[model samples]
Target: MLETLLTHVASAAEATGETTEASGDIMSSLGIDWQMLAFQIIGFALIVFLLGKFVFPILLRSIDERNAKIEEGLKAAREAEDNATKAQSKIDDQLAEARREAKEIVATAKDEATAMLSKADEKAKQNAKHVLDQAHDEISKEVIAAKKALHNETLELVASATERVIGKTHSAKADKAVIAEALKGADK
Candidate 1:
């Protein structure tokens, strides 16, 4: 395999008219000295190192600052959301408190109304009792008066009937007794 590769290389070199294997001639034909190429590569490497230390660091710092700003914005948004949640809770608490107060007020009003109705009913019952007592007393007095008047009238009728039957007037003592009896009945 090595012999085959060497023969191919020799054939290719002959075809390209390369009769000598010299590194200097190859370098000179390419217009590059190996020592100068090495120095130029070193200079490029130094320049890349300087840029990585100074300019690249500035770029990395800017990227880090941008990322920090994004993180701060996210934190602020989370804080705002928390504040909103607290505000909503406060509003809900206020609403619940208001509802409780309203219920208490309504209950108080209902109690007052019930008390008023109860008082009115008590007053009505008392008034009805007073009127009934007055009516009963008046009826008892009227019944006694009527009984006295009826007794007097019955005595007068009996005296007139005796006068018509015997043709004589009643005695004053008998009339006095009849009037006294009528008065006694009225007392009872």
Candidate 2:
């Protein structure tokens, strides 16, 4: 069966205008001799081992360093963002506090001004009352003086009329005594 298959394969190869070489000659011409192949394989294995052991490790270390630096930069950026947020919050709080303080100051000043105004009004009223009392006292004194003058004039007129009726010439001394007595009686 193997011979029949080989014959048929040969015929097929001839029909395709190609011939297959024997395995031994193919292997020898391709330099795939076991001993030489083994040496070549060992050399390639050594080169791969060296690259993996030294060069690859250095490359991985460099890649890791770059990654670490990138991560650190991201962390720093986050920290900066957080700090900025905190600063903004603090500024807002301070601004609000300032506004509150300003309002309180304004209110206090307004209250003080109102109190002062009220005090001024009270003082003005007191001063006006004092002035009115002094005016009343002065007017009362003037009225009393006028009434006393009128009473004296009435007595003088009566004395003159009585003298004319009796046809007596009254002396200055007598007139003075009479007026004095009349005034003393009216004093009661």
Candidate 3:
């Protein structure tokens, strides 16, 4: 190294046509070591080449595989979540339909019940009216029978009293006429 520095100094002095302490001082103050710099650059290149050829490819491949697996997992999770949401939506739609059907069924049942109740009330009213009419008819018949029985009894009593007063019995035809005339005057 010293020989190289001396040769560089001699060449520089020849070129400048002067020999100065300042030139040597300037070269030294720059603090550059050419051989060491070349060795450091070569070492750095070798380290870079080794890492790129051996270590970097392996690490990069592992990172790519990991990325692909993570992406696939994320896609599967999204699909599962979407399917769950769709299933829930379908269930909710079915539930809403069931509720609507239930409401319709309840309304139909209520309407049918109301109709049946109305019919029953109408039937009951008709039955009551029929019973009242029959009772009135029966009462009328009984009243007519009572009036005819009283008329017959009154006729018989009058006929027997006449027989006692006149000291004689009468023919059926004559008794009928006399009873009828007495009944007429009594009715007036």
Candidate 4:
């Protein structure tokens, strides 16, 4: 069936005197010229080869460079963030240490103050006790002196009264000795 169709198409082309070797039955039917098709294919391949060798490489290199720059920028930003975190951590540690030290200092100061106050209070108590003891001793000494004076005066008075009752002058020393004997337990 295809052979008969080709023969009819060839006859028709011969009648028209428009057939050539480049325009075979099938190619002419599809309105394709072989030499012109070959030229177009070669032209398209040349264009692809040129773009691959020159323009494509340049464009790809530029894209690769851009990607590298973006990666570097991201790395730098991450490093900066990490450094900031580390610095903040250090600051926090320092603050904690400082607070701890301050507490220690305050505690030490309070302890010292308490000790000093206790010592001062003890000293004051000791001084007050000493003063009270001294005052009591002085009062006891004064009372003893006053008692001796009273006993001496009473002995003299008794000696004079005994001399008056006897109607005769006895020895003064003898009378005084007798009065002291009589008042032996009474004076105390």
Candidate 5:
């Protein structure tokens, strides 16, 4: 097609009586070849039509799908981040509550221990008092028994002395009078 167009141009130039050199010079200067230019324009238009019909739409759809996937991934990432934050908050709350409960348990245990200690002290004091009272009662009884034994020993000694001094056993009334007189003399 380019060769045929060039031949026609040469024929037209000859019919006008223009020399080949002059026509070549004019064509170079103008830089115009209408037929070749028209063909180039048609080829460019066909290529644009074919790309728009097939390749461009496919590329565009792929880009749109990729963008949608990216957006979905971003949304999922945001949701996961929010869930993590909520889980952390819940854990912190539970930890604080557990700490509070532990403290209360410790305090309650301390209180119970203190109360038990107080009760033990009071019971020990009561037991000590009871033992002391029992000891005092036993000591008083011992003192009374010792006094009775001493009195009986003194009466026997006086009766034996009176019988020895008088040289014979005395009447009961006489013994009683003599013993009373001796006890009075000892007091003086």
Candidate 6:
């Protein structure tokens, strides 16, 4: 086809009396070269075919593999992040549970202490009451003994005075009877 067009252009140039040099100038002006254009087209087609057959598929497969690897890495990272979050949550829950347990222990301790204190207070009160009752009993016994001693001393003094007034000592039975009569009269 290019040759046919070139031959037509040459004949027309001959009929117009244009020389070969003018025809070459016209071709140059048009920037047309059959052999070079054909070689360039063939080379371009071969390069396209080679890239499509070998280079393009390899490059596309490599890109796809790289994208898959990146996606896998992203998935793994997301899973790790989720696992870290779960671990943190578990730790937080454990800490909360520990704190709650500590609080409960403290509360129980406080309650136990209060109970112990109450028991101690009650025991102290009971001991104090017992001691006070013992003291009262001791005081009563001492008072009764003192009163009996005073009565015995008075009886002896009265018997001795009566013996001195009469200028004679009385028998034991008579002394007791006289002292009894005197005591009875004093009571009246």
Top candidate when judged by TM-score against the true structure: 3
Where does model 3 exceed 4 Å of error? 1-41, 164-188
Q: Write the residue-wise lDDT of candidate 1 on 81-173 in tens digits.
A: 999999999999999999999999999999999999999999999999999999999999999999999999999999989778645666778
- lDDT: the better of candidates 1 and 5: 1
lDDT (0 to 1) per candidate:
0.83, 0.82, 0.83, 0.82, 0.82, 0.84
Shift of residue 18 alpha carbon in model 4, Å? 12
Best by lDDT: 6
lDDT of 5 by residue, 90-139 (tens): 99999999999999999999999999999999999999999999999999
Which pairs in model 3 have colliding backbones? none
- Steric overlap count per candidate: 0, 0, 0, 0, 0, 0
Please report how far candidate 4 places residue 74 from its true position, in Å: 2.5
TM-score of each: 0.51, 0.52, 0.62, 0.51, 0.60, 0.60
* Candidate 6 wrong stretches, greater than 4 Å: 1-45, 161-188
lDDT of 2 at 50: 79
Model 1 regions more than 4 Å off: 1-69, 168-188
